[model samples]
Target: MSSPCFPPLEPPALSPETPVPQGPVAPPLPLPSDLSSLAFPLPASSPQAPIPPPPPLPPPPPVGGLAPPHVFGLEKSQLLKEALEKAGPVPGSRDDVKRLLTLQKDRFRSDLWWILFCADLPSLLQEGPQCGLVALWMAGTLLAPPSGIPLERLVQMAMDRGYTAQGEMFSVADMGKLAQEALGCQAELLCGGLGGPNRERVLRHLVSGHPLLIPYDEDFNHEPCKKKGYKAHWAVSTGVLLGTQAVPSLGYSEDPELPGLFHPVPGTPRRPPPPPEEGSPGAVYLLCKQGKSWHYQLWDYDQVQDSNLQLTEFSPERAADGRAYVVPEGGVRAGLCGQALLLSPKDSGR
Candidate 1:
């Protein structure tokens, strides 16, 4: 085989800057063939000039009168202004003002609801001066009392409104329900407006069976109950009972004579024992009526130790001769036996 054919190579010394020699040659536009024959040399570059020093930064603007405009958004500036305004002082701080306003709003709402409730009462029941008086008393008790409104006046108003005594007995249960409702209103009005503990105290006094109003007597012996010739005022009993429940220590007694009984002996100060050891005789006896027989029960702390410490049973045989029967020899004291006897008047005759 013949050697592979190749294109003719141009000499390296021939370049575009070097013109080809031709006698009296006329100039012509470069043709594709002529361009392909020419080779262009790369231009020589000067050494890179030294980088110039950076220009100095301008000084910060002068300290402010008003802040620079639009640096922060318009909304942000407005927010800051609002914050400053809120932080500014009045008679009270913003929080205090807010609390007072909340209290007022609550009071107004409660008053509106109460008025609406009372308005729904039958016309005959709602009519007369007593109704207006009740409304005023309700306002004073539930909201903050208006200036110069006395508790006695409110009591009198309640009396006038047929809310007081029915026959010889005072309707204490009804009054208690009313008191509870009034306390609820007060709680709504005062919550968050007063200090937490004080608010709680107010709530406790109002809702619980403690007497908010105490009767005063010029002569202690000749009080209203005595003068009225009533057995014991229901209000006094209710208030005492309620107060006892609230203060468990004040209300209950562990005395053997009154064990496991609630609200025993009104106004009697309670004396609780020191905590006892596990197996010690921390028993209390309670006078309880079981069917026709009266029994003295013994309790150990919370549990019943003896259901029948002394059983009081009536026997016509003992009563037939009109002589006291000799008490049987027993585990407990003779005085306890006598106590059992004393408990049942019918048994004593027997």
Candidate 2:
């Protein structure tokens, strides 16, 4: 039996003479050797977060930092070739392979980290409530650079091209295809099993140099993330910062007076979170990098008080499975849900 597929988009009946509106082309983002020369620059008026004195250098690298490439069960070349095969060629055009290159100067920059704060695209649903489509649109801008496609045009094209299926939302399963389509060229898109979180797979890809387009279960709270909704949300992982201040260790309580503790619910009067002892561990602060400095900030998505920035104590406890979980200030807990999307070049073979 044939697998069920999303219905193909029906093209509007346009006469041969009908003029097709073209999308605005954006210039490619710059990749420079100097960290200060990032392609996307911070706005001039934006405020910088305060940075505390650097803590002692990070402890020696942890064990099992990453798994061998061999565990992927395929030779590097074979892997890319297979992914390319599954990805197939562009639906209706002939173009060379699309390779998504990074701007990183060194293969290994111990202190360097990557982020997408500078490339922030307001998640406006031009066609519908599809963040996945927004992700593809933004990914295309980063991967293809100089791709000045406007948000409305990108959304319109993606919808018209049938990228959105299944309840008017882009399927996380087909994020790669959307990415390939948006780039208008053959590119490398990778993902972990839809089953659960694969930190190793994600870390391996990050270390390999490509920024990861990770999808978070809005409900999962194990990691410190800024975006929040009751449904799946997508964010890009540009890079990882090596060493930053760790979360202070403090037991959880429902009292509003507790440091690093506040109800994140907007508009509603503040209420204390559940007892930390009963909740799962999560991040209290997200260490964000701007230019050459690392600044600590509360989760941008949740509405915790501005004064609640200082974390009095760092309380991270080990879970039964040997992994350490940090309970957030507000007591929200989430574990790793192993789903992710990787974007790379056709030649990368990762």
Candidate 3:
């Protein structure tokens, strides 16, 4: 007899073609890194709860931050050998890797930070519902000079201008306004709701050397992100993943308890993620930062926000023995907000 394996990623979750829901009765979220009044379940006291200010960013440093190199380097590689080495077992084709590489840049230099995600400015991580703010900070600075504004101040600014409501900054229009105010950039709303007509338009925008601040459900299931009370989250999209097999996949080991059998690594991809597509279509993933952790992520954008959602117990949180982004059974399909905003240098007009 064989031990049951971690189940497959739902079909709905798998086919997000390149775009990117629901409820919960879970206890209120903890105030991790200034999350109070910044995310779901709006803070108890009103008149805009006071947010904690983040620590100051260090002066510019000498070398890059991440050693393992969490992001694509300035030099190019079609096979993604480095990322594949660490973020591998799943490999991307040369074309897909090349296409994805076009999105990364040397955003941070000095002591302040290195790459966004893996080696990041610690101060940016200590704010409330600031996932997008970090993404925005990184996006604004990409291929340009770093802005001195602290993420805490930006959050406060957003708060003061009423860009935030119901514990989240849900409007792309509002985010664009804040981007102009904080980073001196112009943000264009590319698409609203995943699978909208402009889904592929995002690709054109990115290739021009700009990034989109997109919203996503924190759920691994990736669909039907809308719930009754709140719109979930906003993260920055560095680029799109075109079915790169270099992404980590389900790692299996023979069950120690049941000899000759196997069990999947708790949180790795289930069903080996529909392999990199030959043309990079049905498998385009967005390289993003959801602001939940220290590194950027490759998430499926080809998903939609309609009712065809599927729920699963197979959340990334399961990897930590339920110590991570866990949600109740059948509730894992929520959190995929389907909108995006493209931020460009206000001066460049790209």
Candidate 4:
């Protein structure tokens, strides 16, 4: 494959000048099918399988600046280039870029699409337990807030009223309420309350262009953290990639260069890297805004779905230490998560 779409696992810090070597790429590691968290159970496959760690995806360009002139090996269309120009001359400081991307999102090749606005969003915000709030903000960036209520204002109100600055915004109920009241949108929880891993429903939503705000286990995703001190994490499910039955185990393609039925990109050398494993060419992946600084994540389908299952009826560890007469807002003791929240503008009438 022309330069692997992902860098080598745990590779040394790389500069663009480093020459990438050509070798047999390892397949994605088999995550445990067990619905468990950070202190995870082992994978179901035999220990002798040749599964390797997943390839890491690069972070998207700054939203406030110009998008990459070239994506993969294909040159962006003139229309897309013109649109990028409309985002302004600044390379990494365009506030209007989000509005432009929301309008032109469909123009992106599905494989390269996901509403990712990370650490740079709201310069005042920092990555922390506030991931739930950040996920909401990331999703909101793709949607237009109610007239007269700028998205920035809603973010400020959340920081003032929500505990994003103090701690995590892990409460499902409170976050849904925040969406309705702060952003004038409605939030729906798709998988919860003793639900099983349901990729079909999530697939439908992603295909319909409705991204889900999902809860995840930090340890399961291998995110850097203080062991399990704060395990619950939230992210936005921007899009999906699924494999098809055809090809030399090259995997499926959302973008077929023909006038026929949908299929994963064929295993041709011309296509981007195929499924990490030739054995499981039909594997699926979920693209999420894991909110790492300058990084988006490509998670194995079953692993992420199972990750959600592990987060049922979760409660904050510090829900009780508050001053008398002033119960802390984060004192919420219980909440739910399967896929977590499905947010839409109230105007959509979903």
TM-score of each predicted structure versus truth: 0.17, 0.34, 0.45, 0.47
Name every residue pair that clashes in candidate 4.
Answer: 64-94, 65-91, 252-264, 252-265, 253-263, 253-264, 253-265
- Report the C-alpha displacement of residue 255, candidate 4, in angstroms: 6.0
- Identify the candidate with maximal lDDT: 4
Error of 4 at 34 (Å): 91
Q: Kindly give the number of clashing pairs for every candidate.
A: 1, 22, 29, 7
lDDT per model vs. reference:
0.25, 0.34, 0.45, 0.47
- How should the candidates be ordered by TM-score, best one leading? 4, 3, 2, 1
Best by TM-score: 4
lDDT of 1 by residue, 277-331 (tens): 2333322111111111111111121121121122223234434746432232431
lDDT of 2 by residue, 215-259 (tens): 443324423333322233444543322211222123212223222
Better of 1 and 3 by lDDT: 3
Candidate 2: deviation at residue 272, Å?
A: 41
Query: In candidate 3, how many Å is residue 9 off?
Result: 38
- Indicate the worst ten consecutive residues by lDDT in candidate 1: 114-123
Q: Which portions of model 3 miss their true places by more than 4 Å?
A: 1-123, 165-167, 191-196, 220-231, 243-281, 304-338
> Model 2, residue 99: displacement in angstroms?
33
